[model samples]
Target: MEVKSSPYYYSLALLFILNLIGTDSLWASPYFQSGDSIESRREVIEFDESLIEAYQADEAYNYFKNVREESAWEKFKHWLSLQWNRFLEWLLSGISEGNFWNYMALVLKILLILGLGLLIAWLFNKYYVVSQKSPPADQSELNLSEDERLIQQKDLSTLIEEAESEGNYRLASRYLFLNILKHLKDYNFIEYQFQKTNTDYKSEITQQDIRSDFSYASRFYEFVWYGDFKLGVTDFKAAKMRFENLIRNIHNSKTHG
Candidate 1:
């Protein structure tokens, strides 16, 4: 029997076709949605049954499940995707009644607020909280007697001379540079700022030019201390000149002003 179709009947048929497509998209077994939590043991059992049916119908699961040596990162990503799918499902279900553009706008606003909050937190931690800590206790106390200071200077000079005599040029350079830094700290020319207990001394020298000079000296000291490359006689001579110049500058700055 042939039936004539009205416009209402045609529209109804179109809606039914679209609904079938949507159901098929939602029910597809291969691509799991992000953030899908296992809500119940019953849900898990149902999922296993569905998986068994899918394996029987399609041959892909057998091959994938047989892969034994998956990396830790791969497993983590898989679990993360599953959780994401569960979250997405909850979010979509709640927002389904709203207009699509309104939901999208809400999501963007939430993201913007979250980003701004994180940025503010990071700035506060970096500039305000971290900067307020005191310098090392030993560095703050400048109560050394003149004789003690002279003895320290003498010990440092002897160490430098011994290293040079032994032809351990690298050690000699490092000893000389570190001695200068120690002297600077003792004289209150620079404050020892502790990042950790082990690595103390951040330069709080006020003058930019002096800070730059100290940084250059420190870099060269580190290079000689840690690097395997040999320094030539000319390089040693240059280092000595720079060291003497630095001492003179510090003394001059103290006396003239």
Candidate 2:
């Protein structure tokens, strides 16, 4: 036998549904009330509009976005790189276009540059090296040979007269140089030594005019005495005058002092 459902059971089911709905409302009430008050009390912050505009307007403000300035070396490298690239491009274009004459011209230009460089190096070596090399031992008169002791032993005046009598002006010029050196040594102007250079003697001289005169005379002597060239009578006369002037200056300094 199947029993029919009662109205009283339906009323209890409806009451249970209503009670669940009211409980949910009770649990949500505090949250909604607090949220309303929090929203009502909240304040809106006002910023200075000029500060934002000024910062955005300043170009230097974006420090991290700045491009670095290239140094001189870096700029040169970049320029060289660009030139090399352009040259390669031109070379490729010429080759692709079958410009045989242009290619030959370029090769000739490079060879010409290399030849010029070699010529410059050869010229520098020939003249500079020859000037610095010690002259032949037989070139100096009296076999003085840069020996301070031998130079001091000989009478340079008598040697100069003999060299001039033979018309060996080169030998005469050498004697003149030795004469001035001897005078300086005898007067205690310079501490003479075989190992010392003319530059060393120049530094030892204290008088300004004497030092200047010595400098001119020393350079001229090195060219005439130590060089592998013939000194004519006219050249010897000029060199003799320079040496005599230096000697006179030395004498004047001693007399005045």
Clashes per candidate, residues 3 or more apart or on different chains: 11, 0
Candidate 1 per-residue C-alpha lDDT over 167-209 given as tens digits, one digit per residue, 9 for 90 to 100? 7776667666766676566667665433321123334565555
Model 2 spans > 4 angstroms off: 1-123, 139-146, 255-257
Q: Cα lDDT of all candidates, in order?
A: 0.63, 0.78
User: What is candidate 2's lDDT per residue for 145-230, written digit by digit as tens?
Assistant: 55575467667778788889899887777777778888788778898888799999999988888888888887776776556677
Best by lDDT: 2
TM-scores, all candidates, are 0.37, 0.55
Positional deviation of residue 74's Cα in model 1 after best superposition, in angstroms: 18
Model 1, which residues run further than 4 Å from truth? Answer: 1-153, 193-202, 255-257
For residue 55, what is the lDDT in candidate 2? 96
Query: What are the root-mean-square deviations of the candidates from the true structure over C-alphas?
Result: 28.5, 15.1
